[model samples]
Target chain A: MALINLAHGFVEVFQPFNMLMLFIGLVVGMAVSIMPGLGLVMGVVLALPFTYRMAIEPSVILLTAIYFSGTYAGCFSAILYRIPGEPMDVPMLWDGYTMARRGAPAKALGWALVAALIGGLVSSAVMVGLAGPMGDVALKFDSPDYFAAVFFGLTTVVALAGKSMVNSLISLCVGLLVATVGIDSIYGTERFAFGVPILRDGVQLVEVLVGMYGLGEILTRIGQGLHIEQPKETAQKVSTQFPTLRELIDIKVTLFRSTVLGTVLGVVPGAGATITAFIAYGIEKQYGRRRHLLGTGVPEGIVAPQIGATASVAGHMIPLLTLGLPGSGATAVILAAFLLHGVQPGPMLFESPASMLMVYTILASMFASVIGMCLLGFFWIRVVIKVLTIPQGILSAIVVMFCLVGSYANRNSMSDVWMIVIFGVLGYVFEKFKFPISPMVLGAILGPIGETAFMQSMISSNNDWTVFFKGPISGTLMAGSLLALSYPVLQQFLASRRRCAAVA
Target chain B: MTPGAATMPLRRLQAAAPYVVVLAVGIFLYIQADNFEFEQASGRIGPGAWPKIILVMMMATALWGVVSSALRAGHTAPEAVSEAEQDEALTQLPEIYPALVWIAVALTIAYLLLLPILGFFIATIVYTCVLMYLGHYRRPLRVALLSLAIALCFMFMFMRVVYVSLPPGVAPFDQLSYALMAAMGVH
Candidate 1:
C-alpha cells in the first residue's frame, strides 16, 4: 500500500522477459478475442498450460493480463465485422458496426481503442486503490451475512440484468439443478447422476461454458442457415487512435457510476462482468436520453460498458481477500490457480507478506497490461482489420475451423464437440424465442452459491428460518429487496397515469 | 426489434419448455428427496430441500414469463419498435454459424479417428488447417501457411519447450518432432 511497495510491484514486472510476455499476452489475447467463438476463456485456457512451469507470480501476471486485454480485443471484430468476438462485447456490435456502416471505420476503431484503454486503465487503478480497502471491509462478514450477500447476488439476475425477471429466475433454477448434479460437498453423496459416473463429478464449468456459449452458439448459427450476404465494407481501411477529450467527458458520469457499481457488484458472490456490464448499461441508460448513445454509433456510449466490464473483474477480488469466496468468473479461475499453487487465499492472505507482495503484482499487472495493450492495440488493430477484410467465404471458413478447435481443444474429446452442437441448437432456440441467456448462465453460476448458503444458513439455525433473518445484515438486505422490486412498478404506473392526465 | 420479428407464439411456448421440463424433473427430485436428511427442527434443511426451493422459484419465474409473454401477444400486435430495435438489422443472418458447426463435427471425428494412429501433431495440423479454411481463409496457400504457423507456435510453446506429453503421432512425425527440435536447438 505504500509508495515503496508500489515501486517494488513495478520492479517485479519490469524485467525484460516479463515485459516481453506482457506484449505476447497482449497480441495473442487480442487475436483470440477478435476471433468469433473464441474469447477470453479460450485465450486464457490455451495460454494457461504453457505457463504452469512458470513461477507463480509471473504466471498469474500473464494470465491476468490476458484476461483484461482479451475483453477489449473482441470489440475490434464487433466494430469491423459486426460479429461480436465475445458475449461481453455484444453491445459493441451495435455501435461499432453502425459506425463501420456509416463509412467511419477509422473513427469507430479509434473510439474503441481509446475507450478500451481508458476503461482498462481506470478499472485497474480502481483495483489498486480499492481492493485492499474492500478486503479490509470484508473482514466483518460471517456465515449468515455471507449467505445474505449471496442471496442478494442471486436476485441481482432479475434486478440488474436483461428484461424478464421471471425467465431469469427460471434459468437460475435450472443452473442450480445442474450445479447439484455432482457429489454432495459435505455428505459426499451423489444427488442426480442417474448412475452415470461422469455425473459423479458433475459437469465441469469449463466444459459447460464451452458447450453452452461456444457449441450452443455454433448450433444456433447452423439453425439460422448457411448462405449470407456479407458486409460491403469488409475491405475497408480502418484506423485506431485516442478519443477526443469531449468523448471521454461524455461518459464521465457513466464511467464513474459503473466503476463504483462494478466494484460493489464484484464484491458480491455470483456476479460477473457480463452482468455488471449489462447492469451498468441498463442503469446508465435509465437516467436520461444518453441511453440512445448505446447501440448506436456514439463514442462515449461504447466506453461506458467497457469501463464497467473491467472494473467488475477487479471488484471480484475484494471478497476473495476478505471472505475467501471468489467474487465472479475470472476470479473463480484465479482461485483455482491459487489452489493449484497450494496457496489458500483467505483472511490471512492479506496478512502474509509474500501473499501481499503477490497481490501487488496482481494489481500492478493490469497497468502493465494496459500499456502493453496500447502498444499492441495500434498494430493488431490494423492486422485484424486486414483479416476481417478477407472475403466472406474465407472468413467464414476460418471462423468455423477455429470454432471447432475451440470446442475440441478443451479436453481433446468428441463428446464435448457433440455437447457444443446440442447447446448451439439450444442457444439458437432461446435466441429465436427472445429468451435472455444471461440469467440462465448466471443461474447456473449462482445455483451452487445459493444452495450452499441456504444449507449453511439452515443448518446453523436449526430450521428456524430465523438464522437467515437473525442478523441485521440479512434483514436489511431482504428489506432492501422488497423496496427494489416494487419501486419500478410504482414508478412506471405513475408515469403512465401522468401521461393520461396530460392528454385529458 | 422489427415489428414482424415479434416472437411467434409457438416460439414462446417452445422457449418455456425447458423450464417446464426442469420443473417436472425437480418434482421427481423432491419426491426422491423426501428421504434425504432435512432436520427442519434442527435448522438443517438437507441438500434436497435447498434444490427444491430453487426449483420452485424457477418454476414461478417461468410461469410468470410464459403468462406475461402470452398477455403481450393478446394485448398488442407488437408492431411498435422500441428504441432498442432501431438500426438493428434483424433480418441479416451472420455467416459465422453453419461452417463453424460442420467444422466442429469434422474436428471431433478427425480427433476420434486419428488420436490412436496419426497422434497429436498430425491431427493438430490437419485440424488447424481445416479450422483456418472454415474461418473463411480462401486461398489454400494462405490457409496452409497460417495453419502451419499456429501449429508450430503451439508445438514449440507447449510441447517442445514445456515438455508436455504431446500425442506422438505416427513414427514419421514423431521422428520429425525430435528432428525439428534438434535442428532448432530445442533440447
Candidate 2:
C-alpha cells in the first residue's frame, strides 16, 4: 500500500503544475537562504500566504522543497564570504571558510553539496520507512497520551533552547496565554476576550508567525541600521567541484556518524537543523579520525555539519507527518499549512486515500527537492549569489510589505495586521532581552492541542488529576517532562560544584 | 559614586522592566479569566482553567526573573560565569541613527493605518519609496521606479493571480483601484 501510494505521489509531482511549484520553491528557497538575515523559517513563512490559493499537495510540495533547499544553499555564503546565510550554516564557517581561504572554495562547496545529498537521501529513506509505522503507533493514543505527547514537545523545546531556562519558560507561557485568547472549544466561553468581538475569534497562528518572525526580524535588522556587509571580491568566482570517489571513501565514517546523529536528533522536538549541525560539528571535533587537524580546513569538518543539517529535515518531517507535531520552526509553518488546508496530519492522515497520497507526494518531493537543490547549486550558484548585492533597504522594505499583506490576507481583517505589528514589536523586544523565540512559537502551535487533550482527559476521568500518571505512557512522558525541566538547574549545580572542587 | 556605579541601578531597572510588565499583564489576565461565565463541572474543567494555569506559570516565571535579576546585581563576577552564559549575553548593535528604528515603526503603523484609506497599491508604493529612501537609497528616480514596479507586481500577483481582495480604499481611491483592476482584467 505504501509503495503504491508513493508511486502515485511521484506521478502527482510529475504533473506540470506541481513540478512548476517545486521548481519555483527550490529557486526561491535557495535565493532566500543565500541572503544573510533571511533564513529557512522566514522563507517558509513568506511562502505560506502564497499557498492560500494552492491545493494541499502543491502547497506542501512547495514548502517542503523550500525547506529542503534552504538547508543546503546557505553553505555558499558560509564558505565564500565568511557569512552564514542561516544559523545552521555557522558551523560551516569554521572549516568551510578556512578551506576557502586555502584556495579551495569550490571544493568546500562541493563537499557541502555531496554531504547534503547523502544526508538528505538517507534520512528521506528513514522517514519513508518510519513515518507510516509511527502513525500506526499514534493511532493508539488516547486523550491523556496525546496530552502527554504535547507536554513532552513543550518540555523538550524549553529544555533544548540552551538559553536562560526561565526566559524560555516565560516565552512559552506567553505563547500559551496567547493561544487562550479566543472562545474556548469545549465550554463555549470567551477567553481573555475582554468584550471585543474580534478577540472572541482568537488570534491566528499565521499572524503571530508573520509578526514575530517576518516583521519582527525586519524591525530588528532596521534597529541594527539595516547594515549587511557586502561580500568580498572573491565571492564573485563561485562554482562547485565534486570530490573524487577516493575522497568520498575517505570520509565514509564521518558521513555515516553525522547522518545517524542528525536523523536521531531531528526526531526530537525543538532540536532543529541548527542544533543538529552544531552538535554534529562538535562530535566531529571530539571524535573524528583527524580531530587534531580539524578547523584547519579538513573535508570531514565540512562534511559533518552539512550532512547533519540536511539529513535532519527528514527527521523533522516525520513528527509533522505522523503525529501532527512540528519538531522545528520551519515544520511548524508547514503544520500551519496543513491546518490551513483543513487536513489534520495525524494517524487519520494515513487512513484516508486522499490524505495518504498528499503525505506520500510530500515525501517524494523531498527527494526531488534535494536533487534539484544540488543541480541549482552546481550550475546557477553564481546567479543566485548575485542576490546578495540587492540593497538591504530594498530587502527590508519588501519583507515589511509582505508581512503586512500576508497578515491582512489571512482573515481580511485589519485586526490581524494590528496583531502582527504588536507581535512584531514584542519579537524585537524579546530578541533585545536575550530570550529565544522558538519555544514561544512551538508553544503557541502546540498549546491548543495540549489544552484540548487536557480538558478531554479531565472530563473523561471525572477530573482525576492523577489519571495522567496512571497510564504507563503518560507517566513516562510526564516524568520526562519533569527531568527536562530540571536539567538546566542540575547542570548549573554541577558546574558550580566543579568550580568549587577546582578552587579546593 | 562613579559614573558606572551611578548608571548601574538604572540599567538594572531597565533590565527588570519587561519581566515586571509580564507579571502585571499575567496578573490582569488571571483576574479576567475569572469573568468566564462557565462554571467548572463535577468532571469537566471550565474554559478559564487552562488560561488561569498558564497565567499562573507566566507570573511565577516573571517573578523569578525579576528576583534573580535583582539578586545578581553588583555581584556577578565575569570569571564566575559559564562560557555558555557569557556567550548568551546580548550583543548590542551599534545603532547608526538609533531614531531610524522608531521612524520605521511609525512609518509601518502609519502605512497600515493608511492602507484601507489610500488602498494597498497607492499606500504601498508611497510607503516603500519613503522607507527605502530613509534606509539610505538616495536616488529618487530609482526609488520611484522600483517602488512603483514592486507595488504593481504585488497588485497583479495578489489580486489577479492569487485572487486576494486587497484593500480598495474609500471613495476616490476605490475608483482608481477598480479602474486598475478592470485594466488588469481582474473582474
Q: Of the candidates shown, which would achieve the greatest DockQ relative to the real structure? A: 2
Which of the CAPRI classes, incorrect, acceptable, medium or high, describes model 1? acceptable
TM-score of chain B of 2: 0.82
Predicted complexes: DockQ each: 0.32, 0.57
lDDT of 2: 0.86
Q: Model 1 TM-score?
A: 0.77
For model 1, how does the per-residue alpha-carbon lDDT over A1-504 read when each residue is reduced to its tens digit? Answer: 544565677887887767767777777677766665446655665565445466777767777777777767777767777666666776666667787777886777777666566666766676677666665655665667767765665565455444555555665566667778777786666777677765677765444444455445544544444333344564445566566778667667766776677666765555666666666667767763477666667765566566667666666665655555554445555554565466766666667778777777667777888767766777656675454334433433344444444445445555545555455555555555556555555555556655677777667666667776768877876666566556456666897798689879
Cα lDDT tens digits, model 2, B1-187, are 7887887787778778889999999888888887789856665578888888898898999999998886667554657565433322212344456577778889989998899899988999899999997778778999999999889888898888888889989989999889989988888
Give the TM-score of each candidate: 0.77, 0.96
Per-candidate Cα lDDT values, in order, are 0.61, 0.86
On lDDT, the candidate that comes out on top is 2
Q: lDDT tens string, model 2, A275-361?
A: 899889989999999999988899998999999999999999988998899978899999999899888889999888888888899
Residue B115 error for model 1, in Å?
Answer: 3.4
Candidate 2 chain A: worst-modelled 10 consecutive residues by lDDT: A227-236
